[model samples]
Target: MSVTNQTTVTEFILLGFPGPSSLKLTLFVTFLAVYLLSFMGNTLIMFLILMDSTLQTPMYIFLGNLSFLEIWYTTATVPKLLATCLLETVTIPVSGCIAQYYFFFSLGATECILLAVMAYDRHVAVNRPLHYSVLMSIEICLRFSAGSWTGGFIAPLLPTILISHLNFCGPQKIDHFFCDSDPIFKLSCSDTFLAEALGYTCSSVVILTSFLVTMSSYGKIVVTIIKLSSREARKKTFSTCASHLTVVTIYYGTIIFAYVRPPAKYNFTIGKVISVFYCVVTPLVNPLIYTLRNKDVMKAFQKFLAQKRFLLTRNMHKF
Candidate 1:
């Protein structure tokens, strides 16, 4: 490729949900509330897993890693989106834009891998209950978690680097709330076929491989459940993985809809709506999904609250 008179753009204006002032204000308030709630919910999950001994098992260790990831995952984009809602002129430097895209997609990749790991964890617990301890020991779980983080962070690096080197000769307005790959690519003057191809390939590898691993693990789990003789036993076993299945379905559905296709085919408007579901809504609902029906988590939470109450009562008696 050749470039002539490269007046490379330095900054990008994010056209985030353009509308009347009333609409902007409404969006601002709505996103701000969602962001706060998502942050708190994920943080609480991490804290609970850390503080409660009952939650220190392999399953909850994976969950704690997920909670920690969700915190950074949402943080990578939501705050900037909130700014875009409120600010009339929201601009991010080119470097900053690339950084945002990297972190957002990196965390997304991490979640995919982590979810697959969690699925494998579930499969081991269900299919090989006797070997669960040996297979999913805390040390092994920690290694898997660390591997997910490392792979996720590394996966996006090449595509991001290539995209960063592209020349954005003009038209610095990105028609999205945040620095997504498609919107940024749309603004580039350089020939983007190779870069886009690479980006999509890397993304597809992360998404599809992990998705297949999760599905395969779950398939084995389903087979194992079906082998059980008692009807109640099958029902009981399926319930253990039901929450994970729900999360995987929602996460993979929205993510595949948003990212699997070529950027050239994207309708940014529809993409934005889908983005809201996975990027914003999914994180908000995850803690609730994991904890609401979980008897162990409920009991642990009650115990924690009871301990706090007992301490307060003891202090009052001392006074």
Candidate 2:
């Protein structure tokens, strides 16, 4: 194979949501709201899981980490997107693009494995309640969380490194809101086939493998739910799993659509629409779906509020 030794590309211009200049402010405000809510909501959940002694179980521990990941994950892309929409120029240096994709992929990859581990936690809890603590012990939880973070960053790193070495001759524009791999790859003047192929292989490792594990865990869980003798018990179990299943399915479906599928001549309009779901909507809903509906978390939140009120009243009396 022949190689081109040429000047390396230094920067890229992002072609954010395609629309009239008139609409930029509108889009900015809307997505800004999303980004803020996603960050604050996830942050609040993380705090609750940490401060509330009632949430020391294996499940809440994982959920807390997931909330933290969601906050960082959305932060990876949303701030840049907001800036691009409102700033004078949407240019990002080559290094910046790499950094963005790195964190984005890291947090994304972490979430994939994290979700699977959470599913496994649910399975152990529901199907083997007596042994739940034994199976998902503190040590085991730490390992699983560490593995997920490790797994998330391992595969995607090399290809982006490969991309970093490539030359970009002309057309320094990235036709997406952020430095998505596909959009950035298009900016490269060099042949990107090998880079894309490597990326696809890496994606399979992080995405397909983790997805299969999660699905298998859930399958056994469903069977156990059916075998449950009491209808009330079955209802409670299904209720616990349903929200998780919804978020997982939506997150995976969008990922498969955006990344697992081959790169195409994307209609930026449609791409931006789908991007909203994964980047914005999922992050916004993650903490809510996982913890907001949870009775234990709600009870803990109420208790915290009561204590805060009591403290305020006592301080006022002393003053």
Give me the candidate number with maximum lDDT: 1
lDDT of each: 0.91, 0.84
| Local accuracy of candidate 1 as per-residue lDDT tens digits, 1-319 | 3458767789999888878989989988988888888889889888889999889999999989998998898888888788888888889999999999999999999999999999999999999999999999999999999999999999999999998888887789998988998998888888888889999999999999999999999999999998999999999999999988998999999999888986778998998888888888889888888888778888888888999999999999999
Give me the candidate number with maximum TM-score: 1
lDDT by residue (28-146, candidate 2, tens digit) is 99999988888888888888889988788778888888998998898888887887778757888888888898888878889999999999998998888899889999889988988
Candidate 2: Cα lDDT at 149: 84
Model 2 TM-score relative to the real fold: 0.94
TM-score of 1: 0.97
Name the runs in model 1 displaced over 4 angstroms: 1-6
